[model samples]
Target: MNISWQGVFPALTTKFTAEGTLDHAAFKHNLQAQLEAGVDGIILGGSLGEASTLTVVEKEELVERAVNLLEGKVPVVLNIAEGSTREAVRIAEHAAELGASGLMLLPPMRYKADDRETAEYFKTIARSTELPIMIYNNPIDYKIEVTLDMFEELLQFENIQAVKESTRDVSNVTRLRNRFGDRIKILCGVDTLAVEELVMGADGWVAGLVCAFPRETVAIYRLVKAGRLDEARTLFRWFLPLLELDLHPKLVQYIKLAEVHTGLGTEHVRAPRLPLVGAERERVEQIITDALAVRPQLPDYLAL
Candidate 1:
């Protein structure tokens, strides 16, 4: 299960039952879909996966189930988004023990850590686990940007091998390349800018919309990498509206609704988060419905 640190890795939405329990059946259904569609890896318990609402035991269950299900076809990456260094470390250590192939580590949650604190938070976790880590450098949402200076300090840790570049600035990809070269792999974290980032030399996509449309997502990545931009752009254009849903505050509900339409999942989100309702639900549904009505006939991208 060695991660190649390249290609589409779905920051999957955790499936739950109506009573608010982990829906093992639905979760496995989507995981199989992702694998069958040729995703490079599976990232569990991410922001898109509703990490804040999931219990520690539930997260561990997800890791164990994914490990057993994928069985090494692709790496199972558990995301650590804890508020404290100690809690983050504990989660990282447990993920390693549970056979997670790697970790997607966010900066200190809740309290906005400064540059020094953020670097130390990452360094402590990197030292605590043998598993490789992908720094979730999403300053726009998380508010703590891992600057190039911070990365310069953190790069001494060999395990800090990649980054989820979600700053929404596509140019940052080239900046990262210019600054660090091949030392750290860059995976575009924003769905809308995925192709642009990849074109600018990003190594992979840590995608959100891929949870519902796995084949299209994987096809776009392969097409871009294979130098088939025309076909990729055509498919991506069709996917744009659906992909934009990932940018919303209620993205979990929106994506799960898309999943339901595709029969990949249910719209059963955890509490503090409700399923989309009324005009909002209709709006999101129309977008998904419109996209599905004319879903593109993908090329033989697997053969590419």
Candidate 2:
């Protein structure tokens, strides 16, 4: 499961049973869809995958299931969103033990640790595991921006090899490359800006909406990288509406709903979250329906 992290790696939504249990069957079905759509790798326990809601045991099951199911078709990278360095280290250890291919490590959860503490937390986790790490730098949603200066401090950790850049400022992509060059691989984390990020020289996409439209997601990445801008733009124009769903605050619910329409997943989410209802549900459904009504005929190159 050696991954280059140079293509679309979906930040998949976690499927749940109404009784608040992991729905392995549903998740596997979705994973199969992603694989069939030709994603570069599989990322488990990410923000879209409800990593925050999973217990250690639950997370372990997810990693194990994904690893076994993928069978090395793609790297199964686990996401670490923890509040303490100790917890991050422990999760890193667990991912390694479970044979996860890599980790998407977030800054310490809840507490916005300053530069030193944040760097230390990531360094500690990086040191704890052999798994390659992708630092999740989402200042908007996660609050802790892994500033270029912080990344400079983090450069010593050889295994911290990539960044999921979600600052929402596309300029940061250039800034990152200018600062670090090819030292760190950059993956676009925000969905709406994914194309822009790719155009800005991001190596891959850590995508959220791909949960529903896996083929289209992979198509755009391939088309853009292949310098087929006209083709990519044509597809992206149709994709833009659905892509905006990933930027919503309730992206998890919105995406799962889209997944349902696409026949890859269900709308069952764990609580403190509820299923999308009323106007919200209608709004999302309309978008999915409208998009599907005119879904692009993906080129043969995108087929698995």
Candidate 3:
């Protein structure tokens, strides 16, 4: 595919069977749904996919499957940034080998590095491959923050490319635009902040919970891109609560439950991460059901 990637790139769930093994068929089925929902691309193994917990091999399979299934339809952006630069490069190389259109990486977590150190980390990883790279700024969960100045410095790398802004500060997107203009592609990583981000000039959104309701997510983005904020805001109202779940610590579990409730994918998470429990599970179920009750179902091809 020779497409310039854009629009709602919904991070998909890696559906597993009851036996707990990766269900390739279920995953492909979900991919077809996102394609039908009008997304410009699919981001496999993102935060919402519990990607941090997945083994390198498992993530490889997920990206390979997505590329094989949707290669000609949409660009598949892969997120497989491990804690170290070496591991992150290995994953990025592996994904590029499997034909991923772009690489989405996170800051090296664990150690709090200064601006120069952080820039070195990103620059090293980008130098590892030729694929266009997009940085993921998700300070809330990763315990790491990328300052606007740090980002400005990182942009010096030609391959540093785009950014998935999840900082929750909408002005950051505008600030990025003011500094980089069209040089950098700004994607709204925080779903609730999507409308404002786009209104401020973001190119797209990498919605994690949107896997369960991609049609609504893409519809809002398309409307916004068309300068129809009046309609976009109305559609966003329907997705705000669902968007908040991505902010939850148990975002993966909540998103998986929402997918299951809507018959989009299975909710079987890996071990060490217990399946929901007590009031947590009950509360999640109620929220999932309530969200789905009002959501307009995505069309057949978008519904796996």
- Pick the TM-score winner: 1
What number of clashing residue pairs does each candidate have, in the order they appear? 0, 0, 0
The segments of candidate 3 whose C-alpha lies over 4 angstroms from its true place after superposition are 1-5, 296-304
User: How do the candidates rank by TM-score, highest first?
Assistant: 1, 2, 3
Candidate 2 wrongly placed segments (more than 4 Å): none
Residues 1-304 of candidate 1: C-alpha lDDT, one tens digit per residue? 5677999999999999889999999999999999999999989999999999988999999999999999889999999999989999999998988999999999989999889899999999999998989999999898999999999999999999999999999999999999999999999999999999999999999999999999999999999999999988999999999999999889999999999999999999888999889999899999999999998888999898
In the range 1-304, model 3's lDDT, one tens digit per residue, is 4325468888877787878789887787777888877888888887777776777888888878888787568888888666688888887777778888888888886777666877788888888888888888877767677777887778888877788888888888888888878888888898778898888888988888778877788788888877777777877887788888888877888888888776688788876666898998998788778866787543232222
lDDT of 2 by residue, 148-203 (tens): 88899788888889999999999999999998899999999988898889999999
TM-score each candidate. Answer: 0.99, 0.98, 0.92
Error of 2 at 159 (Å): 0.2
> With candidate 3 superimposed using the best TM-score fit, by how many Å does residue 79's alpha carbon deviate from the native?
1.0
Error of 3 at 121 (Å): 0.9
27: Cα error in model 2, Å: 1.1
